[model samples]
Target: MNVSLILIILLVGAFATYLAGDKLASKVALLFSIASLGFSIVLLNQYNLGENINFINQWINQPNVSFALNADGLAIAMLLLTTALTPIIIYSSFRNEYKNAKSFYALILFMAFAMCGTFLAADGLLYYIFWELALIPIYFIALIWGNGDVEERKKAVVKFFIYTLAGSLFMLVAFIYLYQKAGSFLIQDLYNLNLTASEQLWIFLAFFLAYAIKIPIIPFHTWQANVYQKAPTVGTMLLSGIMLKMGLYSVIRWQLPIAPLAAKEYMYIFIGLGIAGVIYGSIVALRQRDLKKLLAYSSLAHVGLIAAGSYTLTIDGLRGAVLQMIAHGFVVVGLFFASEIIYRRYETRVIAEMGGIRSQAVKFASLFMILVLASVALPTTFNFVGEFTVLYSLSQINVWFAVLGGTTIILGAYYMLKMYQHVMLGETNTKPFADVTFNEATTLVIIVAVLFFFGMYPKPITDLITPSLENIITQINRIN
Candidate 1:
């Protein structure tokens, strides 16, 4: 079967979930998500065996656009992350009672479908369509199901919508220009263009605007904390865990390849911006009294490092970025899930309102502690592998970049450990804080297991992504 099969499954699953009505929505969604995951596994096996899984067909003849889904090892890795996490994310929400549950779960599946399409689309216009499609579901999901004041949530969601949409238009323009120059919107065609250095610089800037706003690096990150805090936990997980990676992945897959000269020429500036985000996000996270907001800032820090690694134009840098992206995805979701669990018991997001939970819920405390350590990139955790590789790559460029980027681990450890102590330790809360239920424990255990397993044996992922990353690196240095 072709790569499009996975997309079809998720798309149909969204409709099936909505038709199942509110009562059966979660179960239906989870079942379909698992099916998609299973299919992806089968596809992976086929891919490894040298079967043709890529799909492409003419869509717009005049514009020369094609509906293409290229399932190379890199795309497959991202597709697997989206498919695998979709089930966990859906099952995790089984604990909460959302109103109009059918629509909520349907939106989740639809978003997953769009995200998978984004990862797989090999045509520029087609990829843009999927990219924008992913935004619509999340907008409604956050605006409708999100917690907090109505006005604030609306403002946050709307602003995020406008910011990302506005930035994306610049990318669309760049694509249109490339289509005119190359007479095709295919990725490989654009990659083959012999543009002037000036053209590459403008195109590079256009893409940087879109990716920066989405990745929300530094000054462009104003909307992130508010949106993260206001959106429901599910939306937060989708955003921090998977959606943010879209931008980072695009840098490797689209931006650098299309404008290799610009990427190489201005590498240090972009890397500096990413490093700035690292320092800024860490310092801000240190002061956040709100747990989700703290996690949100923490995400900002991690992605910044990932971005820096991607821009380094080295195999280690790109490979490390991909590894960290996957590692961060699972750990961040687990951390946010921990917050949701605490909120369930106490119905509060304020760190001050939580205390002595460890005494009452030993299982939860231990799991949350593992997630925290994973976040700070503890040795033997998946995060450490990625972080060490990224830091090493940065050092290859400039030792000081490595030193500054390394603050994420140091400041990250201090803030996360301090957060865990205040929220889980000290005097027991008067309210009965029950231990994690079977479902909750299952989700965290799965995430933790993946982290530790990959941390020790990352050869599989490294092997999967390295060749693709090396090709991109070759493209970046082709002129040199």
Candidate 2:
């Protein structure tokens, strides 16, 4: 009934999948991932019924940290998103044959375990440990199973490893400093600290350095495209769909609450940076010839807007960011899976070479088009609900912020549609490109179903997250 059960399931599943051998690895991983998703639903029901599901126990007494896993509505929402997408990502990989398949599938479940812990952990040190643990499996996944030249892949993966690791150290330093002052690493304890303006600013900047690099907003985004292009499709899916949200989630859960003054003082500056990322990512995506790299840039742009929303310090902003986090997670995974389907058939990711796919693959093109529309925030799609709320929040701050952030719609539609034109529309391709099979079609259908269903009825999500977000706003406003 407690949150630790989900973590235990994933950890045990990782080992079970590995032992099942290459022949059964994918199936075992999928089964376990689905089980986690099912159990997450059960926990959600318990939470709705007002049962206590959070776990906290004393650990590391000298530093006064607890082994805490808190499942507030916001954290549960994120946990559900992580759990929901994991099986789809794994299922999407079933068609491709991987070397060392056992390890490949095992790592996917392990990464899920780490990400779930990251979402649930309520102690700062525990959260950081989970955050860093999520990185290790992805590093090996990208370095071993990724595409492109071996040397080039190594360079890209290593850069990502070093870049994120270094940024995280700053966050660790911030945590250590806070622990010194507060004598405990519990989130509630840190949030209660009334630090001076200078202290808050330093802490804010330290946390910003870590999150901005992970979120990779604008100037800190150098490591993104290369890694996305080099990593395998499933690796890319995990990074884009679930991992990127960790930074934005932390901004809401930790940064703004703990350093409300600095966040308030420098709000416009940080929001400006996020808006800048939106414009930059959109423009760069227009120029990408490789499909994955283009999608990577598009992801950067979407998260940028989400980041800007979180900084707005309004319930609308934080809630919209969380909603968009879930929406973007599903859409981006679908887009990448669509590309992977093409790569499997055409054996090329080059946009110049792909054309007339729709003629041969009606179902795939249809599903892909829906995903593209969702990505561009077309009305009635889940993305539109999130994107519209985020823009509205930006507008309340400054019309110009809203104006510039709106460019994602115009530019996004341009590049995404244009990419679709070249890749899916045109005269029938000379080469044979098969349509997606039942497995592939099923995956895309599930994603599309979730998007449309939520798009029409977002109340369930809004209701679940609103109170938690309001509490965060109260905390952020408490000292200031």
Cα lDDT of candidate 2 equals 0.95
Each candidate structure's TM-score, on Cα atoms with residue i matched to residue i, is 0.99, 0.99
Q: Residues 43-142, candidate 2: write the lDDT tens digits.
A: 9999999999999999888879899999989999999999999999999998999999999999999999999999999999999999999999999999
Clashes of 2: 0
When summed lDDT is taken over every stretch of 10 residues in candidate 2, the lowest stretch is 427-436
* Candidate 1: segments with Cα more than 4 A from true spot: none
Candidate 1: the clashing residue pairs are none
- Candidate 1 per-residue C-alpha lDDT over 154-237 given as tens digits, one digit per residue, 9 for 90 to 100: 999999999999999999999999999999999989988999999999999999989999998988999999999999999999
RMSD of 1: 0.7
Candidate 1 global lDDT: 0.95
Model 2 segments more than 4 A misplaced: none
